[model samples]
Target: MNDRWMQGPQFLYMKEEDWPYTSRENYHAISEVVSVIPTSKFESWGKLLRVTAYVCRYMDALRGIKRENLALSSEVFQRAERVLYRHIQAESLLSELEFAASLRKVAKKTAQCSSIILSMKPYLNENGVMRSMSRINNAKWLNIYTRHPVILPDNNRATRLLIRHYHDKFRHIVVNEIRKKYFIPKLRQLLIRVRKHCFRCKMNVAKATPPEMAILPEVRVSAFTPPFSYSTVDYGGPFDIVHGRKIEKRWICLFTCLVTRAIHIEIAYTCSTDSFILCYRNFLCRRGTVRKMFSDRGTNFIGAEKLLKTT
Candidate 1:
């Protein structure tokens, strides 16, 4: 249907009702109908473009179909959609791509006069609609849409509506197939807008990105340090240990070196300050004195630390 555009009316499909631009008066009539839309919902053309970028509400802008009808067959809806798309391209995009179409002649070609549309090999049909030419013309196995796709304006109202129309149960995956029939600029941006506005998908399907971890502290990164030089102490459980015949509960004081991750332990029979002082004394004797000591604010540890500072 698209490759036949330059070949004239012979290759084109035009039914009586689908001819939105049968004459000058008829085309204006259709445009006027579309222009007479409610100003409240669409404050300006910009507003319409923004709204349609995700979800479209301008269903009856041209009164092309009776949307209020209870049941509309998929065939009728698709046909009306094709008519609407062509009408939209005729209204705005055709004029934008006029220079690109004129570039078909080598005489009109200029290095200074370049357009993005020209890169897509854009051409104007009999109705002055811009459609892009594809390199897959020799592949008879492919469909007409794959051979020549219509070049649509980026973030336009018509383009938005078409994207929303195809956005069904598949969600974002449909963008791949949409490339087959339309040459919309920044199509990924359009898909991003769709994803952002789609509340259901954003809430349920979107994954959270974890933040990066911070750098290690000086104590953990320091090298060439003696065992227990930069060390932290903590007291663990009252494990049962048999002393002669009777079993006794004992607490273990643990010391860990930050750099080398060396462990040293001392047994304290009770949780009293005297018992902890004896246990810390034994750890210092075996593991050597710590250059920096780190420990929780336990009363027993605090008392032992006060004595060590006083000494």
Candidate 2:
């Protein structure tokens, strides 16, 4: 090959009409360069070439547009960048597939006749062989065997790539997709490991631990205490009461004994401080004065407490 071709494609003073010829020449030069590189580097080199082409196109489009058209130039550059980014992502996926394929090959050889398995022959039982019979029947199952015997291996990088491709779906979904072609041992564990490390999945995962239960107070747990020693008060309802031709609304104050779980109900015509005080007086007369009282922090309860304290 000529030194000019070896030096790679260079466009200098080229006319618009020469683009077709120049592109062909560029392709030829790229092929020559690619032939010398290792197979592993091919995907990366192809991605670089695509990005270069996109940048060149972007520059060419910008050249035709006026300098005053900043918006158009920005838009063109952004679109080109997006395309380049996508190409890079695709190249990464291709690399992952290649690595997984290599692992699969190694695993196949190991499964057929591995020194590791022979070493563990003393420990393997008839049950083990019977359990592995299904796996042994299928050559595809060999993909799970790696350098070790008891500890099965998987292409974690490839599995993660597949999971991300499926938008980080549940373990069962990913397992189903993988089982379509290859058998991966502990697939659920593998998926869980990937998802646990995934930033998006971790952020979206709900906390597995439940909220701690509040500690029980002394009054609720004390044994053999009097029924009205400590009481909790709450209001319930607006029941309709019919007297002759007139219908009226009534409310009930519920006083629950913290020790004995006993409840005392008092009637109130209105949810007012005076009405609540009367109800409290009735409760004191019937169940005896409570040493401690718990309430729902209602306005009527607060007003009644202040009135009782003053009286």
Q: What value does the lDDT take at residue 77 in candidate 2?
A: 50
- Model 2: weakest 10-residue lDDT segment is 124-133
Tens-digit lDDT string for candidate 1 (124-203) = 66645567777887998887677777788774666765566556445757777887777888888887777677787678
What tens-digit string does per-residue lDDT give for candidate 2 at 136-199? Answer: 4345535433211221224434334444444355443776655543334556777777787778
- Tell me the whole-model lDDT of each prediction, alpha carbons only: 0.68, 0.56
What is the Cα-based lDDT of residue 11 in candidate 1? 21
| Backbone clash tally (model 1) | 0
Find the 10 residues in a row with the least total lDDT in model 1.
49-58
Q: How many pairs of residues in model 2 come into backbone collision?
A: 0
Q: Estimate TM-scores for all models.
A: 0.47, 0.47
